[model samples]
Target: MAPQPKHKNIVQILTPVVLFSFFSSSLAEIFFEERFEDGWQSRWVSSDWKRNEGKAGSFKHTAVKWPGDPDDKGDDCFRHFAISAKIPEFSNKNRTLVLQYSIRLEQDIECGGDYIKLLSGFVNQKKFGGDTPYSLMLGPDICGSQTKKLHVILSYQGQNYPIKKDLQCETDKLTHFYTFILRPDATYSVLIDGRERDSGSMYTDWEILPSCKIKAVDAKKPADWDDREYIEDPNEVKPEGYDSIQREILDPKAKELDNWDEEEDGIWRPPKVPNPAYKGPWKRKKIKNPNYKGKWKIPWIDNPEFEDDPDLYVLKPIKYVGIEIWQVKGGSIYDNILLCDDPAYAKQVVDEVFANREPEKEAFEEAEKVRKAKEEEDAQRAREEGEKRRRERDYDRRHRDRDCYRDRYKRHRRGYSDDDYHVS
Candidate 1:
């Protein structure tokens, strides 16, 4: 069968969702999103990454599960290197900031980033690079053990800080929906495949949260405070012969060999073993400490820098949405990026996109497995056929040699000249 085109009919698969987005809820405004359905190349600014890394670079569009080798420059799929698009401006002030996207890590990621960043500063469309500043970076950042986590970094006051809780990301070679929602009440939630995995108040979860309360300026630990809860007994003492007993003794089972000679052969000695009755580092028994107080702590006072703005949940103006990444082996297909202010609507987007994807994924995996199995079977059959042909050739050669030897022997034994066997 002739191979099918790499990119085909992806927009048809997402037509329903794309049509629905036009009729999406009026309250929730979708500032930016990309399904990469058709002609998505016009939307994004593709970097000329071929000059630098002559080996692997570029992102392509394809409907199939496997897009084929990325190094093939002639393949229809090697479209762009990195993902970075110019999006419209939108503000999350007093509204929920929902950032969601679909990503498939289709490559064997040894040590690289499989994450996306949402940049907000004044970005040069053609000059976006790895060092370009971004406001929020979310998704799995995989390297060695030094960094392996679902990195959630939110920039506040020109400083970037990570979320306090450890959010583990999906590392499997499959498509996953990552949704990050920062609500108007300073609370944030992250969902994978439409299931909530991590959620908390951004004020408490991120170090960017300004301290509303602070320690008192003159606070100090009282000098008379006693924090110890246990003390040694006053009358405890060691026994008279405690020090004389050895901590280890010779094992009775380890008998000296009978052939031992002290002068010439050197005598064998029994191996020393731990003494069963030995106790290590004897100390006085602990007693309840009287007049003991709890651990000392300083009182907190109001922080002058903190002004309760009832709108801590409100984020700054979001101008553009982009995927700033530094992937090592780059075959990460990113699509269906929906930015809105409604949780239910965002979830609706997820449901619409991945509604039947679960079943499709299963079928896709099964097909791949079958393809591999068939390939192995074909390879084995070819090997067996080659071996059979080799054996037949060997048999023919042996029979030919036997016939030539018989003819030569018969000619020599009959006393005829060797030339008589030839017709000429």
Candidate 2:
């Protein structure tokens, strides 16, 4: 046979890979994406639910304060904000769902929630608030030191269940990306700044369903059961005079002062210090109990109430994505929200769009240094001015006092009455 061309062989080998890539890209679908560019207000609905109470915050479309793409504007929340955008209804019944977004806590958020909610079904976009029903909520909730965690809450059967895992969130005054992926197999993954922070089965991580096995309530410890592993040694007894040892004793080196009088100073006593010879209350030595039983555990039985859910990972038809937050001191900028069915796409967005975080952080640190330097300089100038004023006041007061004294002396030399030379 004639020799086969090398290029033909290479093309034959690469055909399957290229086809697979094409199919994979076609399968990935994006349900919603918000970049907060111009004309974004037409797509988003700002709720007036708290506006009458003056609690509704306004969102300004602006770019990051530090170094970043000037055209990359985000929704800047200055207070309590409730805004949402309607997305095409989609069901993630048998596919992976990815929710990703970027947040910039420019004000170093003291206490507030920076989470976004995915609402299912019909929602009055004009009245969307905290009470609005949502299928999923994902983002960081910061409240001082105690609450600085990224929350991942999934709603199932009218009840919302929060993730049991404690995931620490980024608290720096810079932009960060938060990504969450929920697979059809009931497994979920949480990522922060493009790094996987946590991943596990949704069945185990969330309390959406009853446990498959539970401790038997009917099982009880028998009357003869002995769970203690150790007992006091029978041969050990309290030593003689042990109870008489005092916890505190007079210092031997302390001496009464020579000037101290017995009647005036009361009875002179040396300060009491911790006694060296004294041991604390006696404790009998422990010995391994011969008849000791191991820890008693109630037998686990199949939970009758437990029911396996084949669709435990399925959320309702998500139709709207919202940003409803309550911030005390707000300067959080939310941007680049994406809802898709492919984690790979979400990761690519992070690597491309949100990759300027390192530069943003560098710019923030440099700005902070400049601000601190300016504050210190202003403080030093204020101090110098204050000292100058104090010196001027002191000089005037001293001169005035000397003049008064000289006038009194002159009056006295001239034989004026003592009352005539009254000091002012």
Candidate 3:
């Protein structure tokens, strides 16, 4: 080993004291006074008072109970303050800064919006007229949980360091103290109530510098992104069965291409051959028949008409099952029933199906309207009942006062009558 490292007596004697002082300052514990004396000296206290406008006034101080009248209408969340002086100024190289304090929120309000934010790295925005102040934040944005808990968060440069602590408090009394420590270096760690609860680290490139200079950032103009130039809507009405089963036959995304008909020549068309037999696009896969096991002599099903056009064949009644259909050469027969089924019955069924659906839709709308109407009616009735009760109470109070006044007048007249008559 090299010569034993020299340790001066002075350094050895003072090391523990220096370390203790450093830790004591970093801890920054708050002690509550026993009596109801000046609460301001007990750092980060609130003096929020309820004003006549049902809002908390700007004046903040310290008090024993909640600072204002309880009927302020706004939330009675914590209006206290927090101060941490242990955090040091950030330089380019220095990485770690930690601050810890005890926070106890009054249980009078809902805990949904309770939060504790440790702020440091101060900057004056009034000098630059900028929106954000230069600081780092590490705290809990606790909402929806009332159980006392602790949180650890780190803010390095501009991005948030994702480290958190959720610890159940040992007690619920307002005087509970929790010690928190934050370190933003190779990692961030938090100690809650003298125990380490969480830690996290951040990537290196996120070191954004705090600057006092302000410059004009670009504001986007509204016209850049809009594409609605000029297009007229035809508002076409589709047939009843259009949305029902027709979607099964058509590829949903396939629509007529907008510019397909436009070209240098008149109505551009694809090349076609005339007088060709129906050699369909189906291959060997279409040759196999469905499993029947000779149960019924359904020989007409083997013909290619059923295979070529299922929409036409599947609906044909058993009477026309074997009828062989001929190819109609280019004469458009649009207004004809292609299938041999009872077309009138099919039409009736389709109409009746849509008609039945209409009542369901109408009933849903009616129910919604009725619910809304009932709610309004209930509110109106409540108001009327309240007014009636107030009027009845006022009448009863006036009647009581009138009877008391009459009795007092009779007593006075009886006392004065005999003496007054003799004197007259």
Candidate 4:
């Protein structure tokens, strides 16, 4: 027997760790990814459904005004367009499904949708529009002041169900990453900019299935049940003069005008004013009812119509990723789309690729500052020029009037007829 070298022992210890890392990486699968680089036009098909109507807008392969990436490239959707790309068919059965993407609303989108859809079954990529059926739809939708939320809709049993909870989304002009993860345990999580914004069980957040318990149809409150907790005090009596109190009274400070004539005008009467001492209609003071009972409710029983679904989390096989939106004012740059099973991988992509958010924001702020300053400068110049023009016009009009007056005086001294001096 001989002692092993130190390097050989280190190698033996590191070998298993290396092998585990390799195998762990293999577990994560990337079904589709779109960086929106050159050659993106070849992969995507634009719909012609609204082309004849001239409602379909085209997508530009460009970059945000401020470049977060060194390569400054993304899918610029400047108008309403429906575009889709075919992805490898895959089902999220007994596995995690992750949808991640980055969006930059450079145009300060007032009303538009930035959602992406995961379509299942056969799809006509060239004609995919709002009517196309999808298995999942996720992203932010901003419309005026009321709607500014990240949508997470799932299709189950041929019906689409949006998340019950209202999840606020990023509405700034900077770039943001939206991530959605659905696991095999019927649990889903929503992440914005690589941080968890919301997470819950699908059963609780979506009305995909009938409730496990429902109010019993036969259960009803008894006719004699006193559900009211408070009632008017029977023993309390109203003040004697409460009913006689008038809401309006003649003003004590009002005085009859000295010129007021009772013969010409109707007899002068004091104006009625609101009486400060008079309270509104009387209300009886409430007291705890002696016979009061808690609120009566129909008792819940096991719902006979409810049926459990073990595979409720499983979605149909998705084969395409589509984007169909109508933008009123479009300058949204979409980039770094990814669909995979591993959340860690998605986060890593965000960390590595979309990490320049701070820089992008700084660039945008700098540009905005410059733009505002320029506008202010232009406004000030316009005001100064307008004032100068106004002064020149006034000076010219005054001088012209003075010259005409002098001419008229001279004509009078010359004894010319008034009609002959026309003040030219």
Candidate 5:
């Protein structure tokens, strides 16, 4: 029997189906299998197993339950296992060396101990077996140490931060999810049950790939003492540098002046009135009073020769002082707009304030004058130097012109002598 050609739509559908099936099978081979009784399978391998530096034995044989329970009855146990493969998904220029494993904890125990540990963060195959890497335990057991705590650790540039804490660990009968996203910057973060922890900034800095800023936990801490820890992503922090800001100038308008009040003890107090009559423009006028038109003596003016003494006639110094103090305390808007209502009053206060500090103002003014004089001197020196250069250039050009004329005259004399010899 002859075979029939497949339909175009059927080929298209089958192509994707076959591709998806192949992809799923390949991923299944790479990822650890989830078996209930067996715990989690390992998807990685260590090269230093032969040297006895790592957990020695077969991949599955070395996978033992925590607290050395062979029955696997503990809350934490390995579920699956595999030899490590070069994970292209998690590998790049910013290489993050990580060992991931699946762990199952039965219930919230007094102390949680099931943690996917990373012994070393380097791919130096020989270093793992050497004395250097063996001497240091690369990671810490965060969840196993604290009750009801699920901890995820992220290490970047030799520094470590716990990505997750189970102070508020949620308990459910179903599977509890804990996954980490490792970036090329050697920084990582964890998500539990699809929700991120409050300390998510660690992941942000790692993902953002920012330069690390190492700050002392406490600014005033001693070199030997441990600083009180604070929540901050070192990578996201501003680097130490300098910045400039524009300065603000005070406003030109403000307010002053009000009627004198004696009832209030702390209020304005008018100066004592002089014994002599207060004189004004009206007092000097020749207009006669209604009662005594013919007589020059006015009732309001007891003494015609009265010359007002400001010390006795003016308002008390305390009254003016009170107004200035009020304006200063009234804030920018009140001080600039309300208190400066009368230009005359504002100018008077300013003059009085500056009059008392005339020496300091004069000294500043003298310094500014000196600075101006120095600048003028520098400009004059520059002009003189430029003029000198110009004069030297002009003199050289004149000398060159004279030399050219002398050379031409010598050449003409030689030519005339040669012509005469030829003629002879």
Candidate 6:
């Protein structure tokens, strides 16, 4: 859809809206917001990851409380987590870079990475995992069926790039709300849960803005470049005996097999008939190539690695912002982080933290239907208490085998019973 301009007076929204008080941006300030409340684990930092090694989980914390709790339940185990956080100096040279947060997968996210990262050096934030090194990484990655876009990488100076926009994220499970901005005149936007789907120009949506016109390193094309627009008709010729016709023909109303006895039925032919002005393999009519010089452009030049970047959407002062991911079925629930240069204060922190994400996703779907009906009623009362202790151990082993078969028939009717039922 490539057309979302709307940055005019930065923002306005009124009719009793009051979001960002006249759409913020008086040189927009607030460079950090993180509402993980409760001292955010002393400013967020976890990475000693355990559970089955290689890319494991552990970053915990949640007071966005209630809902069958494992951080507001859904996809049970925080599926192989990875957390990060630093926050402080979010520079944009002369302003413009407005990340915004508030996610919420909570299940139905098969094959992971619920995006979120916006870091910048000072590195080792408790040895941040997932191959540390970040500058800009926006969320929602999904897998299976070759991933569903909306990623947005962008490191610039030290490389990174990504985000040529295929951006189509939000796959179910509620509570979205992403919103990047960038803009120091290099342009970019992208919002969800707050509108706008896409917007361009990090010099045409990013490859870190280099091509201000390339393609002509002597793009070369002249070996008499006629690009063949069309030409076989030098007066169309091909009519004499067009390949002696023979492409499966014999079925000319054949009815000569009746009581045929011409020399023992070997001479009553009448089948091979397909010469109806047979025009099988003869072509000759193309025409229009007056030395067609129209498909050979090698022009455009001037990109000595381009130069007019108007601060290619500046960066490189960002202090920190992380949430590095890789969840496979972990209940996601990031909340109102608001690093800013204010696209109206990240739309007024997404209307005050996503206005209770639809009543916290309807109380996490009624606590996932009361946690799947109390795990199917505690697994049907542990399968009816192990089927009542296996029917009381098969009714006390059938009444103790009928009292040891009536005491071996009264010790063989007092015929000097052997070892008295052997009870040592």
lDDT of each: 0.68, 0.79, 0.31, 0.79, 0.30, 0.67
The Cα error of candidate 3 at residue 93, in Å, is 5.3
* CA-only RMSD, every prediction: 10.4, 15.9, 36.1, 15.3, 41.1, 20.8
Model 3 stretches with alpha carbons more than 4 Å out = 1-60, 65-96, 111-122, 125-135, 145-151, 164-171, 183-185, 200-424
Put down candidate 3 lDDT per residue, 120-237, tens digits, no spaces.
Answer: 3442211211122223332233334455444333344344433333445433212222333323244444544335555443322222222222232333434434333333333434
Task: Please list the residue runs of candidate 4 whose C-alpha ends up more than 4 Å from where it truly belongs after superposition.
Answer: 1-24, 216-299, 396-424
What is the C-alpha RMSD, rounded to one decimal, of candidate 6? 20.8
Candidate ranking under lDDT, highest first, comes to: 2, 4, 1, 6, 3, 5
Worst 10 residues of 2 by lDDT: 9-18
**Where does model 1 exceed 4 Å of error?**
1-24, 49-56, 66-80, 144-147, 214-316, 371-424
Predicted candidate 4 versus true structure: per-residue lDDT over 1-424, tens digit per residue:
4432222100000000011122444668989977754477788888886776655666544434666544575444334567889988999999999999877777666687877899999998878987888999998888888899889999998999999999998888777889999999999899998999999998889999988889887887899999889999888888999978999999999999999999997799999999987989888899998998899888999889889899999999999998767666645666677899999888887776545667767788888999899999999999999999999999999999999999999987899667886866
Best by lDDT: 2
Cα lDDT for residue 262, model 2?
90
Worst 10 contiguous positions by lDDT, candidate 4: 9-18
After aligning candidate 3 to the native by TM-score, how far in Å is the CA of 78 from where it should be?
Answer: 7.2
> How would you encode candidate 1's per-residue C-alpha lDDT over 1-424 as one tens digit per residue?
5444353211101212234455556777878867654566778765554334342244433344532221111112231234467677667887888888876665555455545667776877565656667778787776655566787888776677888898877766666788999987888999998899989987679876578778886987888888888989989998777777788999989866777788886767788999987787778899988968877778788788876667665555676666655544434556568888787888887777665566657755876798899999999999999999999999999999999999999987899777977885
Cα TM-score per model: 0.60, 0.71, 0.28, 0.70, 0.25, 0.31
Deviation in angstroms for 23 in model 6? Answer: 5.7
* lDDT by residue for model 5 (287-357), tens: 32333323222123223344333221111111000000001010100000011112223233223322323
- Candidate 5's C-alpha runs over 4 A off are 1-102, 118-146, 157-159, 163-168, 171-173, 182-189, 197-199, 203-424
The positional error of residue 361 in candidate 5, measured at the CA in angstroms, is 86
| Quality of model 3 by C-alpha lDDT | 0.31
